[model samples]
Target chain A: MATILQFDFPYPGPWGEEGARALKDLAESIAAEPGLVWKVWTENEAEGIAGGIYCFADEPSALAYRDMHSARLASFGVTDIRAKVFDVNEGLSAITNFKIA
Target chain B: MATILQFDFPYPGPWGEEGARALKDLAESIAAEPGLVWKVWTENEAEGIAGGIYCFADEPSALAYRDMHSARLASFGVTDIRAKVFDVNEGLSAITNFKIA
Candidate 1:
């Protein structure tokens, strides 16, 4: 079963292009992690939040990535991050057709 | 079971606060729809993309929101949107603890 990981983080005080640039770099790095299938990155300026949906090949891969991401975000001075990991049920929708490779 | 809905859309050419504003309005409207539990909205300027992760009470509610959202986007001249729906497997992770209502 594919693992879905979702998370959101609030930008530190007075976020701007610089903060976004840093996040972009971080997101790109996470996307390259082994077993990562795909990720959708999102940001909301007015709300001062950013997050994404990620799919991984397995639970271990997803959990590993989550730990790495959380630590990286903390190092960047980003706090108040919320994350959840989910197991994808193939029978739910056409999502079974979505594959990483 | 809680239904997870994830989607992304490229903002129409040269998007700005105007596009985001319109999307906020649409998002707020969708959140009010019955059976919707929560939604996390995101945007990216450099990438020119916006999206969110949604939790719904059931499949029918999620699908209904999708149709409405698509039509609203079309009316706003947006195109090439991507969407996927997933059934949350409670046993997969701790996601079963996340609930609507």
Candidate 2:
């Protein structure tokens, strides 16, 4: 089973192209995390927030990564992160073609 | 490129296995919708909400489907759907191993 880790935090600027540039290496690195499957980079410039929805191999990995990511962002001077982890409904998700293998 | 549709609405009961059973047919049906790539069903039982994060073929398909979904949910006595659409940042998404194909 997989888990989804969703998080967001305040980022007043550097969205879209600029954000892409700033986070490119970080994005690539997270993609290489041991249990990671994928991530959907999310941003709402007008809403003053940025985050990603990540799919991980399982709950333990998801939780571990959440702690690691939260700390990493804090080291980058982003401390007010909002994070949540969900159990991926695999049986239901397959109906929408979400890759489970 | 893909468009991301994020939405949530009040649903106080039937989470996890029960929710899966209730929404299974709807999930299968939506999977067959034109331009839909995938949807990750989400729920917060304590928070009284249910929704999904969806990836679609393009922006127009996303918006069109959002309207259609809003209408459908309303017909099911669910009228207060909260929805937002985002243009997928393909380059950055690719960096995170998102399947943009």
Candidate 3:
């Protein structure tokens, strides 16, 4: 089953171009992992949070990515991170039938 | 079963305080809808996108929110909106057991 991992963290304060650069580097690194299928990065300035939805090959891989991501976020001094892992139910909706590019 | 709605879109260009203010207004309005349980707004400048993950009471309510949201995004001249709806399977993962505030 495809597993979905979602998480978000606040930027402590306003994140300028430097922060954007850091996130780009981190995302590229994480996406390079073998088990990750794809990821859709998301952001909302009004809410002051940033995160992504990742689709992984399996539960173990998803959990592994979670650990790695958590460590990386911590290294960047990003605290108060929240995340969840979900098993994608193909039968749930027509939207689930198609993958997000 | 709880339904999950995830989507994102580019901000066209740099979005400053005014853009954030517009989003805040939209979010507040959406959250006030009768069927929405909760939503997590996410943003990332490096990727140049913003969006959210929402939980709704059912499919109808989820779809309704999508239409309203899409229209609002259009009003703001935001294009390339992408959205997907999922039925939350409570048995998926331990993380699914807890909701993001």
Candidate 4:
């Protein structure tokens, strides 16, 4: 079953077009991460926060990525990271088109 | 273009098997809502909250539904109904598999 990983952290800037352009490489890297089916990048630049809802092939890969991400963020001095993972309720999800890839 | 609507509100129960069973009708009704593409149900049962990340056909439909939903929640005494709508960045999202359908 797939897993949904959601997380947010204190962040500022680089969420708009300019930021997207600047972060294209970073975005590409994330997209290429193994087991990551997709991600919806999220940000409230004005509120100084950013996160993403990620769909992963499974839980282990997602957790590994989360740990890696947390460590990376910590290296950059980001904190107060909040994260959670949920098992996809495929039957209920299908009703809402949460398709299984 | 698609829109993502995210919201959260306090709730004490009905997020597990029993709650889902009781809310089956509500879930079906929501799935049948016009302009709704899908909804990934979310809940932090321990924290007493429930919401979902909803994909809509367009921004207007999404906002319309949001307003309607807010009214309905109020009628049910659901306060603090937070909501936000975001335009899907198709290109960037495409890289992360946010297909525009």
User: TM-score winner among the candidates?
Assistant: 2
DockQ of each: 0.04, 0.52, 0.04, 0.41
Local accuracy of candidate 3 as per-residue lDDT tens digits, B1-101: 46667867885433444444545545556657867776645444555766666767777998888988898888989989977665432322112123322
The most accurate candidate by lDDT is 2
DockQ, Cα level, model 2: 0.52
The residue pairs found clashing in candidate 2 are none
| Model 3 chain B: ten consecutive residues of lowest lDDT | B89-98
Interface RMSD of each: 16.7, 2.2, 16.5, 2.6
lDDT for B61 in candidate 1 is 94
**Best-to-worst lDDT order:** 2, 4, 3, 1
List, residue by residue over A1-101, the lDDT tens digit for candidate 4.
58777777877766667667877877898898989988887666555777777888988998899999888879989889877666555546666665644
lDDT of each structure?
0.60, 0.80, 0.61, 0.75
Candidate 1, pairs of clashing residues: A43-B42, A43-B43
Ten residues in sequence with the least summed lDDT for candidate 2 chain B:
B82-91
Off by over 4 Å in 3: A12-22, A95-97, B1-101
**Which is better, 3 or 4, measured by TM-score?**
4
**Could you tell me the TM-score of candidate 2?**
0.79
When sorted by TM-score, best at the front, the candidate numbers are 2, 4, 3, 1
Candidate 4: residue A78 lDDT (0-100): 87
The parts of candidate 4 lying over 4 Å away from their true place are: A9-11, A44-49, A77-82, B15-17, B44-49, B74-82
lDDT of 3 by residue, A1-101 (tens): 56667877775433434444545545556657867776645454455766666767777998888998899889989999877665443322212123322
